[model samples]
Target: MVLGGSIAGLFAARVLADAYDEVQIVDRDTLIDVAGPRRSCPQGKHINGLLARGQQVMEEFYPGITNEIFADGVPTGDLCGNVRWYFNGVRIQQQEAGLTCVSASRPMLEKHIRRRTAALPNVVFVEQHDILGLATTPDKSKVTGARVQARGQKREKVIDADLVIDATGRGSRTPIWLQELGYGLVEEESKKVGLGYVTQHYRLKSDPYHGDLSINPVANATLPRGAIFTKTDGGRVELTAYGILGDHPPTDQQGFYDFVKTLAAPEIHEALMHAEPLDEPVAFRFPTTLRRHYEKLDRFPDGLLVVGDAVTCFNPVYAQGMTVSALSALTIRNHLHSGAAPQPMQYFQDLSKNVIDPPWEMTNTVDLSFPGVEGERPLQMRFAQKFLKLVQYAATKDKAIAAQYMRAAGLIDGPEKMQRPGFMLKVLLKGIFGPAKKTPAPPLVPIAGGHVETWSEYRNAA
Candidate 1:
């Protein structure tokens, strides 16, 4: 049994379908047939995209997912070649990292994965149910099932299972449930990131960047504003303006555009000027990033495990949440191949050390670079930032270094890949003697010959 119907939950259900006789999914919201956002998915309503590694896992779990999404009108491209990333106020060089990635509204993509998972004969979606807690053996040594209450019902029903997993995202109740079962408390690490964003959909009236699938200006300490503009289904675009350190993007129409005006790059703001608005600018707040150290617990219930954002929630701008969840799901598939009963402790340990730590450290390090966002910056981060700036500078002139850095950013390669002697020499020599081009923020100007569309001609016209 899986607790939640988010992408994490769906993936878990899909993988578990082969191992278990019947895979049941309990979700708080009603499932939908169409590809659109839902009331339960506040996170999906904003700007969201999958990283290269995420696309790999999703497609691996569901064969032909890439072609499936493309058929749905979601744009596909080379991970590094089609994306323009701005860090520390400078654009990263464009190069083909040879990684397949997709661009679509988060809601639309989730709907496709949900559709695939729901189609499995062994998988079933039990909608409009609240997960009360876990049902365990008398000694509380192992979880037997989950206690759930259907919406508008009084009595709780216990659905027995050989294994129970929680993919309920950042708001999961697993921690509380564990404590109630006499388990030692799991340590939680949280970074107070006062992040918020305003998002709206637009129809791309013009293509100025020459088929670039994505435009992004990341947040930095000097300038805490950022934005992402990308083509989704129906020849329409989604513009998400965001800020950290309590600099919330306003939701008013003009105020929303005003937020765009503050981004490090003018490309997104410029595109919005010529496009049409398909929806009102909506706002969402991400107050903090939380990571639960379930691996630290000495004793955990045998039949229970937590995965995805229920384990660690990253700042969405990095686009790590979905990908990290995918990694965890992959781990689940690997362990299940052993055909042993689920082992929560061993899974958590591997997940924490192999999957969660590196990305969590990288994200916190970048967030702390802002100075306004408070956190510890040990020597590793300090040293990494220096070398990274050098790499960023060198990447503008050297495609080799750019490709390596982009692959690392896409999670296809480890951080150690950038530290190779040959790569380091290239960056060092390029920084020493190269025709460096200065990439200042483009002056924000209106793109001519385009109109603002308040509504869409076709929702998924791809």
Candidate 2:
């Protein structure tokens, strides 16, 4: 049984169908046959693209998934050569080779995944039933099934299952349900980003960028601004601009234009100025990056597992959610293939350790750039930041440097890959001889209720 029919749930269901005799996905919203937005998916209208790693995972889990999406008119392009990435108002120069990433609307991608999952004879999608509680054994030790309530239904029913997986996303009530089952309290850590998103779709009347995806600007420590414009599955484009903290963007027509105008790059504003708007700007607020450590629980309910956003939700700016979800699904497949039917805790611990580490480090380290987030950054983080800036500086002049940095950014290589002797020597030489790019002045007023003594100290404290 899978709770919540989001992308995570669909992908999980797809993987589970191979191992289990029957895999059922329960969703609160009405599941649709066509590619359209559901009530639960507020971000559906926004731009969504599959990273290279995510695409590889999808094709691995379900063969020919990318070809299917492309057949549906989704645009595919090289991540390094085709994409225009901007960091700190400086455009990343193009490289010769990069990963071929696919771009599509949220609805289009979900629709394809949904179709693929639904095709399996062992899989079923149950809709319009909100999950009420977990049905456990008499001793309340193990989760046997889920209690669900459908609107206008006379009575609730218990759907039995041998195993239960929660892909309910950031708003999951699984933690509360676990506590009700006499399981110990779940430990949670959150970093409040105070970020709100404003997204609008437009009909691409003219392709000034010529079908290429472009980012207006990357998030800077000093200026928290970024935007994405990409072609979706149906030849339409979705543009999203994010504002930090209470710096919310307006949903009205003029307000949307004004918000685009505020980005570090002027191109997005100019594009919106000329394009025809297909949808009104929709606003959604994400309060924090949340992770629940169910694997760390001393006593967890048996036959229950959590995946995707319910496990670790990163800030969406990094676009790691779907990729991480794909990784979790892959982990599930690996466990089943191994023929070791260990406890769900064992499965979750292994999955959390393997799949969650890379994206977490990459995201949290970058999150430290925000002025208000509270965290401790070790010396390695400072070294990494300085190294990245040097790489970026070099990438501007050399295609090979740009390719290396893009590969790392796209999760093709681990952070330690840069620690090789040859790369380390280059970084050291660049640090010594490269023209020192002026670092932005730190915020004059302290944000965390204290004054930072110096930039080095501030980076360490963050």
Which numbered prediction scores highest in lDDT against the true structure?
1
- Listed in order, each prediction's TM-score against the native is 0.93, 0.89
- The best candidate by TM-score is 1
TM-score of 2: 0.89
* RMSD (CA, Å), each prediction: 3.3, 10.1
Residues 71-152 of candidate 2: C-alpha lDDT, one tens digit per residue: 7677667787867766666665676465867787888889888888888999888888988888889998778999999977
Q: What are the lDDT figures for the candidates, one per model? A: 0.81, 0.75
Model 2 residue 242 lDDT score: 85
lDDT for position 58 in model 1 = 92
Residue 362 lDDT in model 1?
A: 77
Cα lDDT tens digits for candidate 1, 309-410 = 999999888889889888998888878988886688889988998888878877877788877777778898998876776787787777778788878878
